[model samples]
Target: MLASVTGKGVCLCTILWILDTKGVFSLKNVTLSIEPSVVQYRNTSKLRCTYDLEGDALYTVKWYRGSLEFYRYTPSEKERDKRKQAFPFKGVTIDVDRSDSTQVTLNDIDFVVSGEFCCEVTTEDSHIHALNNCKSMVVVQLPEHPPEISVRGEPFDYGDILRANCSSYRSRPPADLTLILNGITVNQTEPLALRKLRPTDYSDLQLELKLSDLHFQEGQLNLQCVAQVSSVYHETVGLELQSVRHPVPEKVSAPNTASAASTASSQTIPLRLFCFTMLCFNAESVIKILIKTIPASCVTYYTVVATPVCDYTDIRINSLDKFYALIVVINLINIKMPHNDNPK
Candidate 1:
């Protein structure tokens, strides 16, 4: 019952004997291939069914979503009619016009459409009947929104500790999460990270980066968190340090030398400028000048006085041993300097 073919006939007694005894002539090979086995919701997918028939006796091809048959093609009829085709199962949609005898196309697929699919072929013949089936798996990944980045620190600055967290919208398959700082990958080993699975079939990923004694480059550094559902699909967020209080660099000199006094004198101008920059401005104010000096050894001492449309007066005190306050009712003046200065 083999079909007519254009092949050489090797009519050997041993081959014929083995084929008859092992029932090899009745076997057929069927294979089904699905494109983009993993996909996001609302995406298109294609399925192809192929088989090698030993004999062509009105073969029928069928496609199934799980165990439910959704599409079929009969070779006996030249044109497939739409009126007699079977309806697709609930939550599944297929393009009947585009699908052919060996192919199935699903459009606008969603999370509910993910499942096992089967392709089957059967031939009609009394003595030489043959049937074959093949199965494949498909998964629908959910799309996630842009990731969110948050920082847990106050007055961000160098030589400080901080933590950053990046989180994405709920998604299936637990979006692949990564943290990159200055274009370098940060992993769980470097920072204590935590990952969790939600009860809603979603994923939650988090990373905790402990940056102790933050570096100078880190001030201008960029931190980014990226989450991906697939190779071509993902979201990212970036972070930067904010302005904060920073310790000033100290300039010291050798003890009992002329250079020591000169160095301290040159450094006082810039120190006053630094203090002026840190002051907070307000509208309603009275004149307030407070000067406190603690000279450990040999160091230069300077004083700045500010008057606001009022009479000028010079005030002096002997020692800053105890608390003292000098209040003026109309002007405000402030001088900035280091808390303690020692030469040598």
Candidate 2:
């Protein structure tokens, strides 16, 4: 009887000792990395989360967003209840395998699934325990709109110089812009290569098409341009170019009081003086006076007013507003003509 009682006492003591000396197991070297940080529209991306642990201790795993629960797994039961109970996790999936350490695979991410995540694993050895580890999942969204084009220029009336611009302000990658003028790609994408053909904005994927050669046929010239953009989001978009109507330059026969400004370049200032000397001898003094006074302004404005001498002359160029550089040069030539030398 005494031997039996001693055996029972030893068994009880062993149970207590086992409970007091629990082993401490920890999940160390935990890592999570996604294959692509940027996800394209309607695409699949892989995500891997893994860790090394001391033993095959049953872990109670749970994924959380702030205070809300994302997913949960108990290694002892080792069952996955696939559910996206959280705000954006409803479409996501998880794969867990404890044999090769715990790994969770998340799939089908959208713009809303981007946020911070923590993987919780509980482990214990014959000593202590551990709690939580955090990582990040980032999902990039695709571009929705193509590059928009805005065309600027004086529209209506023939010879109204127009400005055209194509800007892809909302795209991740810059756009490849093309200019289609009157059924022809008139401008090639080259540096300073015969660009006088049309108006183009080098800074913007835009253009400034001049109505120099195009006339108001039938009614008005139909001008159109388009901008194309391919984005990192694996999407390509083409925007309709803006169209503007500019009028054909008017036939001039009216007289004006303001002194006419010459569109002649500074380099041609000397040539103009020689022409003025000839006009004084052959043409009316009013025409000669105009040649002297019509500096720093457009010749078109002056010729319309300087007597009806050259009524049929049609060497029409765009008014001084087309080029800023030309405006300064043509307006600041400082031609020196004295009123005393007017044609007598």
For each candidate in turn, the TM-score is 0.52, 0.34
Top lDDT: which candidate number? Answer: 1
Best by TM-score: 1
Clashing residue pair totals per candidate (backbone < 3 A): 3, 32
Tens digits of per-residue lDDT for model 2, 47-166: 445666656464555565455565665545533333212133554644333212344455665555566667665664554455666656555432345544455544444466556554
lDDT of 1: 0.56
- Cα lDDT tens digits, model 1, 115-217, are 7888887766543444556555545465446777776774456555657676666666556677776677764212212444542243344555555444335
Question: Model 2 — which ten-residue stretch has the worst lDDT?
Answer: 324-333
In TM-score terms, candidate 1 sits at 0.52
